[model samples]
Target: MRWSSWVLFAAGIATGANAASLTQVTENFGPNPRNVGFYIYVPDKLAVNPPILVNPHWCHGNAQVCYTGSQFATLASQYGFIVIYPDSPNTADKCWDVSSNATLKHDAAR
Candidate 1:
């Protein structure tokens, strides 16, 4: 795996899933910025109320390009609950910050 791939792999592990399984597809969703992705699946028969995330795909990749949001849904759903993945922006350091660093927290007050 490449250096960045490892980082993505680690994210999959951190999410507590055994492995990452993903595919590429275009999905229709609410007003979401470009790069958003999701893999809707039937909730697992076992889970009553599964956990979710604010921006699951924020740091993850596209299907398999970076992270496996589709696979994540497959697993997360099989385990019960809903999984809504968001596409995070890709920027330097693998993070999104169109504005300069000095503008991240407070450029107005300065």
Candidate 2:
């Protein structure tokens, strides 16, 4: 089956169920020079070594708004995967620093 069709089928299975909301991660994972906000959504039934889905918000968008407005949380619940929503540190424009090479390199923000 097509990937899109499979997702739709899975989402349909838990139509009335309440998916878990995103939770802010307080503990530091590592150096965050950009001061980006981290949020996560863990499904009730998690798959072994589940793949992570990073859902970064668009310009002028925050983690909470993206979580509530998108299907990532619901899909995570249905598919038993983890979802991460990272809030950009660029408060001036509320956008990610994609133009900078430092931000693009692996663990460059540190």
Worst 10 residues of 1 by lDDT: 18-27
lDDT of 1 by residue, 12-99 (tens): 4334432233322242323333343443223424254445532343332432332342455556656754343434445433444447
What do the candidate models score in CA lDDT, each in turn?
Answer: 0.39, 0.71
For each candidate in turn, the TM-score is: 0.34, 0.74
After superposition, candidate 2 runs with Cα above 4 Å error: 1-19, 105-110
Candidate 2 structure lDDT: 0.71
| Index of the highest-lDDT prediction | 2
Which residue window of length 10 is worst by lDDT in model 2?
A: 7-16
Stretches of candidate 1 exceeding 4 Å from the true structure: 1-25, 39-43, 54-79, 89-94, 98-110
Task: Give the top-scoring candidate (TM-score).
Answer: 2
